[model samples]
Target: MSASDDYKRLQLALEAAGLDLWENDLVAGKVTHPATRTFQELGYTLEEVGDSLAFWMEILHPDDLPGVGAALEAYRDGRADNYRSEFRLRSKDGQWVWYANYGKVMSGTADVGMHRFIGVTFNIDDRKQREEELTRINQLLSAQNQQLDQMNGHLEKLSTTDPLTQLCNRRAINERLHRLVSTGQPPSALLFIDLDNFKKINDLYGHDVGDILLCQVAQRLQSCVDAGDLVARFGGDEFVLVIRETGNSASPFRTRIEYLCARILSILAQPYLVGDLMLSTYGSIGVVCFPDDGWTVDELTKRADIALYRAKHKGRNRYCFFQPNMETELQYQNNIETELRTALKTRQLELLYQIQVDRNLRPVGAEALLRWHHPVRGLLSPLAFLPDAIAGGLIHDIDELVLDTACATLGKWQQDPLLRDLTLAVNITARSFEHPAFADTVMRMLEKYRLPAGKLCLELTEHLKAQSFPDAAHIIDQLRAHGVRFALDDFGTGYSSLEALKHLKFDQIKLDAAFVADITDNTTSQAIATGVIAIASAMQIEILAECVERHEQLEHLMRRGVDRYQGYLFGKPLPQSAMEAAMHSTLGAQMA
Candidate 1:
C-alpha cells in the first residue's frame, strides 16, 4: 500500500482505540500525522502540533525529557529496539495527568530525509494510582513484620525467666548449656543445690515468709557467683548454677562455688523470724565439672544429683563433689530403685516392730519399722531403700503398704488383754504427709481393719516444725479429728521443735537419738534432753528417748524422769512374732 494509504488506516485505528498517533522525521526535524483531532483535544491546534520534534519535547514534564531523549538516542544508535516513557503532561483544561508514550524505530538510514519514527500516548492516571497504593501497602507490611519479630523476642525472654527471683529457669539454663556444648564452648561447672528441709520454714512461719527467704537466697547466690555465671531455678527448693572458668581450677571459679556453698549454708543456718515464729534453715549442694565430670546437660545434672544424694545421705547441710566413686553409688541407687519396684510388685516388704515401754518399764506402745525381705540380699532396712523409693516416687505406695500392715497388726494386737490398751506408732514422712489422699487412705485402712483411730499414733519428725506451718496445722487437725494422736519425733533437732510442742497438740515427744546417744558424755546434749523432758512434763506430753544404748545414757535419761525409753537396751527391731515373744518373755513375768 502507498505510504499515504497506510498512514490513513493507522490514523483511523488510533482514533478508534483512544490513542493519539504521531510521526517524527528525524532527518528533517519534522512531525506528520493526518489525524489531528487527538492533539486538538489536548488544546493544541493542527499547526501547533505540526511535524516539529521540538513540539513533543516541549509538552513533556521537564524531568521526563532527559529519559525520553536518552531512549531516542539509544534506539538510533542500535543499542535498543524500542522507546517507552511515562510522564505528566498538560491537558486542555490546564490540569496535569499521567500519560504513557511508546514508539519504535521505523528506519535505520543515516540520511536525515529517510529517517522516521512512530509513537502513541494514552491516559494512565488509574494505573498510576494503583501503583502508589501498592507502594504504601508494601511499606506497612514491612513495618508490621519488624514489630512482630520484636514481640517474639520479648515473649521468649519472658518465657525463660523466673518472675519472682529474676533468674533463668531450668529449661533456659539447660538450653544455654546445650548451646555452649554444641558450639564448642570452654569447660564449666554445674552447681546443684537443694535447701535442706525447706518445708520447715513454711510449715513454721508461713509461705509468705518462705517466699521472702527464697528471694534473699536468690540474691545471695547472685552475689556469690561472677557476672558471667548463671543461677537458675530448677524447681521448688532446688537451684542449678552454671559457672564459667579461666582455665585454672585454682582460680576464683572453683573456689567461688565452694565458698558460695559454705556461705549459703552459714547464712541459712541462722535463725529466721516471721512475726512470732523463729526458725532455722540449711541446704545441701552438689558440684559437677563440665567437660570433666560431664560434657552434656543430662550427664552434668545426673552427676550433680548423685553428689546431692551423697550429701543428704551423709547427714545434710553440706556440699559434696562428684567423686569417681559416685558412679558406684549411682549404680547402687539404680539397684535400689529396681529392687524397690520389684518389692512393690511382689509384696515382699515386711514390717518389724519395736516395743515402746512406759516410765515404769511397762509396755504401752510399739513403733512400726519397714523391712525389705530381699529374696537374694536377705533383709534390708528402710535406710537402704527408702530414699530411693522416695526419689523414684514409690514412697506413696510404700507408705500405703506400711499403713495397711500396721493397722492389721494393731487389730490383732488389740485382741490381747494386756496389749488392748497399747497404742501403735507409725512414722510418716513428708512425702506421705503431702499426699492429697492421705486422709482417706488412713480412714479407709482404719475402718477396713476395724482398728480404733485412738490406738494409731502418727509420728512426724520436727522437720515439719520449720516448714509450711498452716498446711501442717491443717493436716494435724484433720488427722487428730479422726481420733488419731500425733507425736513430735526427733525433737531438740529442728529450730521450731519447742514452738511445735506449744502450738500443735502432741501426745508425745521422742528425744532425738543424737541427744540421747551423747547424753552421758555431752553435757550440752544432756542439758537439752533435761530441758525437753521438763517442757514435755509441763505440757503433759510424754517423752520417749531413742537410741538409749549405754547404761549411763539410759540411767541419766531415767533419772531425768522421761515417760518412756526405747533403744537396743530394750530389744532390737524384730519381726512381729519375735517381738511378741520378747514381750512375752520380758513383760510376761511382770503381768504374771
Candidate 2:
C-alpha cells in the first residue's frame, strides 16, 4: 500500500475509536501532528490553535503540570511500563476540561530525523466528574456515620450518667446494685447521704453556686472512695456510696463503715469555694448493709431513706442506722400537714408584699409573698411551712387565697389614683395555674374588682413541667389576650429557662435572686447576668433584678440594663395596708 493510503486508514481507525493521535518532534520542540479533533470536541476551532508546543503548554492547567511531568519522567527513566497522564486543559469556552493521554517515546532510527513522541488524547471529563462526585458522597456518608455514632454514644452516656456531676445516675446505680446481687459479690454498704442545709445554701448562694457545690461534693466523694467503689448521685441533694468489699467480719466492717461515714461528713462539711465565696455545708448519712437491710434496690433505698430522715430528725450533720422504731418521721410530717390544713382554714395564712422598684428606685409594683402565722410558732415565712403545704397538696388552696386577697387589695387600691398603677405580682404554682377554671377565676376576679388586668401580674415559676406547657401556653394566651401581663419568675435558676422563653412569650423575666446575690463581686454572675439580659432584650422582654439587697448589686444590675428591682434593699414584705401606705408615701414624693 502507498504511505498516503496507510496514513488515511490509520486516521480513519483513530476517528472510529473516539481518539486522535498526536506527534511531538522533540528536536524541533513543536507538535507536528496535533490532536485536532480533541480541541474541536472542546469547542476550539482550527483557526484558534496555531499547532505549536507552546499552545499545548499554555492550555495545560498549572495544577496538573507537575503530575503530568512526573508520569513522563517515570516512563523515560524506565520506572513505569507506560506513560499515562490525566490533566485539565483550558477549553475554547474559557473553562477547564479533563483529558487523558497515553504515549511512548520513539527513538531516532536510521530513517528518522529526530526523536518523536506518539500519543492518543481523549476526553475523560464525564468519568472524572462522576468519580469526584462519588468521592464527595462517600465522604458525606462517612461523616454522617461518625456523627450518628457520636449521637448514639451521647445517648447511652445520658442514660447511665448524671448530666451535671457526671456520676452514675439513679438508673445506673440501680443497675449496679442489681448486678452485684445477681453475681453474689462481697456485701456492699450503701450509704445514703443527704446534704444538710442544701436548700438554705441554694437559696442563699443561688443555683449557680449550688450547682458548683454539688459538683465539688461529687468530686470529693469520688476521692474518698476506692476505685472499685461506686459513688453516685441518687437524687437532688442526695448521694449514694457503694463500698464493694465490706469484709466478712461484722466488727471490721462496722469500723470501716463508721470511718468512711465520718470521713465523708468531715470532708463534705469543709468550706466549698463557689465563684469567689467560700460556703460551708454538711451531710446527714444513712448507712445500710446490702443483703442485710433488704435484698432489692427499692427495699434498700426505702430503708436507707428512713434512716436518713432519722439522722435529719435527731440532728443534721450526723449518721444514723435503720431501726424498727424509725417510723417517727412520717408521723411528724403528718402532724405538720394537719397543722397546715388548720392554718389554711383559720385565716392564719396571710399575704405580704415586697416592693418592686424601677431603676430610679421608685416603686412600680409589689410581689405578693405568702406568710404563715402558726398559732404555736408565731409568725413565719413561707420558707418555714411552704414545703409541708406543697407536700400535702395544699398549695393550690394557698394560691386561691392569695389570688382572692390580692384581687381585693387591687380593687381597693384602684379607688385611689396613687396606688392604682402599682402592679401586684402573685406567684402561682404549676398545678394551680393548670386548673381548668384557673383562667376563669383570674378573669372573674379582675372583672369583679373592676381592675385592669395589667394591675394583676401572674408570676409563672421556672420549674413548670415541660409536658404541661402546651396547656399552660393556651391559658397564658387566653389571659394575655385579656391584658394580663405575665412575668417569668426565678428565670435563670431552672433547667429549661431558655426553653421556656422560646415556648412562651412573657412581658418580663425576674432574674433569679441567686444571680443577683453575688453579682457585684463575682465575674461569673456578671457574665451570666449580662448574657441573660442581652437575650431577654433581644426578645424585647424586660429584665427584673431579684434579691438586690445591696446598693452595689443595684448599681451592677442598672449598668447591665435591668428594668426593675426587688429585695431587702427595697422593702421587706408587709401587709396590704402597710404596703399601700408606703406606696402612697412614695407616690406623693414622686408627684411633688
Candidate 3:
C-alpha cells in the first residue's frame, strides 16, 4: 500500500480507540496532531493545523513540564525505548486536566540531523480524581486508628495500676507473681511490708494527711528497689516488692536479700514531711524467696503473711523469714481461737485464785487468774490460750467472764467472817481498759455483789502507759473516785515512764517476775529491782514483789521495805474450792 493510504488508515484506527495521534518535527520546529477537535473541547484551540512546539508548551501544567521534558529528551537520545508520562495540562477555562501521553523517535536516531516523534494522548482526569479521594480517606482512617490504639493502651495501664501511688494494684501484682513462678527464670523474693503505727496516724491526724504519708512511703519504697524489681501497693499501708535477682542460685542471694530488707526498713523508718507536719513511721517486712518458699502465688502470700504476723508479734519494725514451725504454731493458735469462743458457754472456763501475802505471810488479797479446762487438752493455763483469745478479738468476753467469777467469789466471801477481810485483784487487759463502758461495768459489778470498791483491785500492765488515749485518765479517775484500787501490773517490763506514773493514779506497783526471777544472782536485776522499789517508795506507792519462789528472795524484798508478795513459794494458783479449803485451814490455825 502507498504511505499516504497507510497513514490515513492509521489515523482512523487511533481515532476509533479514543486516542489522539500526533507528530513533532525536530528540524521544522513544528507539531501536528489529527485530534484538533479534542483539544478544542478541553478549552484549547490549535490556531493553525500544524503549529510550532510553543503552542503545546504554553498549555502544559507548570509542575509536570520538567518531567515531561526529561522523558522526551531521554527517548530522543535513545536512552529509553519509548516516552511516557502522566501529567496535568491547563484547559481553555483555566481548569487543570490529567492526561497520559506516549511518544517515540520514529524518523531518525540521535546521530541524525533531525528526528520525527509520533505519540498518543489520553484524558485521565476522572480516574486520577477517584484515586486522590481514595488516598485521602485511607490517611484519615489510619490517623483515627493510631489515636484509638493510644487510648486503649492508656486505659489498660489504668486498670493495672493504683491511682493514688501509681503502682501496680493487687491484681497486677498477683499476675506478676504467677508469671514469675510459672516461668522460673530469674530467682525472686517477695517482701511483704506493713506500715507500723499507720492506723494511729490516721486516728490522730486526718485521712488527708494519712494519704500524703502513704504517698511518701510509696516513693521511698520505689527508691529502694532496683529498676528490674517492682514495688506494688497491696492496698492501704501494705506494699509488696518483687525483688528480681541475677540467677536461680539462692546462696549468694540470701545476703543480698537481707541487706535489701534492712535497707528498706531504714528507709521507711525515716521521718516524712506531710504538708506542715513531720510524721514518723516504720515498716515490718516479711520475706519469702521463690521456689524455696512456695511454687504458687497463694502459697507464697500466705507464708509471707505468717512471717508478717511474727514480725508484728516480736515487736514491729523488723523482718522475719517464713519458718516451718510458725505454720504449725499458727494452726494451733487457730484451733485454740475456734475452741476458746465456746469455752465459757460450755462451762469450761474457770478462775483460779493465787494468794497474795503480807510481809508476815498473812493473806491480804488474792489474784484471779483464768484457766481453761478443755475437753481434749485438759487443764490449760492462760499462757497456752490467752494469746489466741486476744488475737481473735475475744479477749473482751474472757475479761468479762473473769470479772463475773471474781465478783461472785467476793460476794460469797462477804458472808465468811475470815475471808471477808481479804481483797480480790483481777488483771485487766489494755484492750478492755480502753473500752468506753469499762468503768461503768466495774461499778455495776461492785453494786451487784455488795462488795466495797476498795476491796476490788484492777491491775493493768505497764504497756498501757505508752499509748495515748484521751479517755484513759478520765476512766481511771472515775473508778478511783469510788474507792476502786488500781495497781501497775508487770511494772519495769514495758514502756513505762515517770510522766505516766505521775499522770495515772495507782495504789500499788507489782514488780515484773523477770526482775524478781534473778534478783539475788544478777546484780543488774537486783539494782533494777531496788531502783524500782526506790521510785515506788518516793511516789508513796505500795510495792509488791511477784514470783518470789525462795525465802531468801522474800527476805531480800522485805528488807527493801516491800509490803506485799505473791509467788509459787507462798502458794500456787488454786481453784475456788481449793482456795476455800486453804483459807479455812489457815483461819483454823490462826484461831488455835
Give the candidate number with the greatest TM-score: 3
Candidate ranking (lDDT, best to worst): 2, 3, 1
Q: Model 3 residue 104 lDDT? A: 64
Query: 1-592, model 3: which lDDT tens digit per residue?
Result: 9999998998776664556777777677777443464576576556633477776777788899998878767666787667777688777788988876776667776436445777777665665689775465346536755223332333465567987888898988999998999998667899999999898899889999999898899999999987788899999999999998876546688788899889999999988998789899999999898989899899999999999989988889999999889999999888878898789689799999989999888888899998899998899988888777888888988998899889999999999988998889999988888876788899888888998658899998866745553467888889898878999888887766465686788899998899888877889888988898999989999989988899888888888888999999988999999988898787668778
Q: Lowest-scoring 10 consecutive residues by lDDT in candidate 3?
A: 146-155
- Residues 456-484, model 1: lDDT tens digits: 99998766635456667787898888888
TM-scores for all candidates: the values are 0.56, 0.48, 0.67
User: Tens-digit lDDT track for model 2 on 1-592?
Assistant: 9999999999886665556798888668777787988888778776667656788888899999999888877777677655677789998789999887877677653134446888788766765579875465346546755222332343465678987898999988899888977887876888899997788788777898899999999999999988788999987989998886745546777678889889999999999988789888899999888778888878778888888877876768999878756666566777888998888789989999899999888899899998888888899987787766776778778888989998898888888888888888989887688777899998888888888768888999977878668878899999998888899998888799988888887998999988899998899888999999999899999889888888888888899999999999988888888988888898899899
Task: Supply every candidate's count of residue pairs whose N, Cα or C atoms clash at under 3 angstroms.
Answer: 15, 0, 1
Supply the TM-score for candidate 3. Answer: 0.67
lDDT of each: 0.78, 0.83, 0.83
Q: CA shift at 251, candidate 1, in angstroms? A: 4.5
